[model samples]
Target: MCAAGLAWEPLLRLCLSASLVGCQNSKSFEPPS
Candidate 1:
C-alpha cells in the first residue's frame, strides 16, 4: 500500500498537470473546430 501510494501520487500529479496545461492551451490558443 505504501509503495502503491507513492507511485500513484506522481502519476496523479502528472495527470493533473496535463489537464491544467490542456486547459491553458485551449484558453490561450483557439483551435479551429
Candidate 2:
C-alpha cells in the first residue's frame, strides 16, 4: 500500500538519522592518552 509505505518512510529516515548521530558521537570520542 502506498499510504503505508509513505508513512514508513519518515520512520525509517528518523531511525537512520538517529543511528547516524549515534555513530558520529561514538566516532568523536577518544581514549585518554
Candidate 3:
C-alpha cells in the first residue's frame, strides 16, 4: 500500500495538469455549435 500510494502521486498530478490545460484551451477558443 505504501508503494502504491507513492506511485499514485505523479499520476494524479499529471491528470490534474491535463485537465487544467484542457480548461485553458477551451477558454481560449470561441463558443460554437
Which residues of candidate 2, in runs, are more than 4 Å off?
1-3
Error of 2 at 8 (Å): 0.3
- Residue-by-residue lDDT tens digits, candidate 3, 1-33: 999999899999999999999999988895876
For candidate 1, the lDDT comes to 0.94
Task: State every prediction's TM-score relative to the real structure.
Answer: 0.69, 0.66, 0.70
**lDDT of the candidates, in the order given:** 0.94, 0.91, 0.93
Q: Write the per-residue lDDT of candidate 1 for residues 1-33, one digit (tens) a residue.
A: 999988998999999999999999988899667
- For model 2, where is the 10-residue window of minimal lDDT? 24-33
TM-score of 1: 0.69
Best TM-score among the predictions, by candidate number: 3
Which residue ranges in model 3 land beyond 4 Å of their true spot?
A: 1-3, 31-33
By TM-score, the better pick of 1 and 2 is 1
Any idea what lDDT model 3 has?
0.93
Clash number by candidate, in order: 0, 0, 0
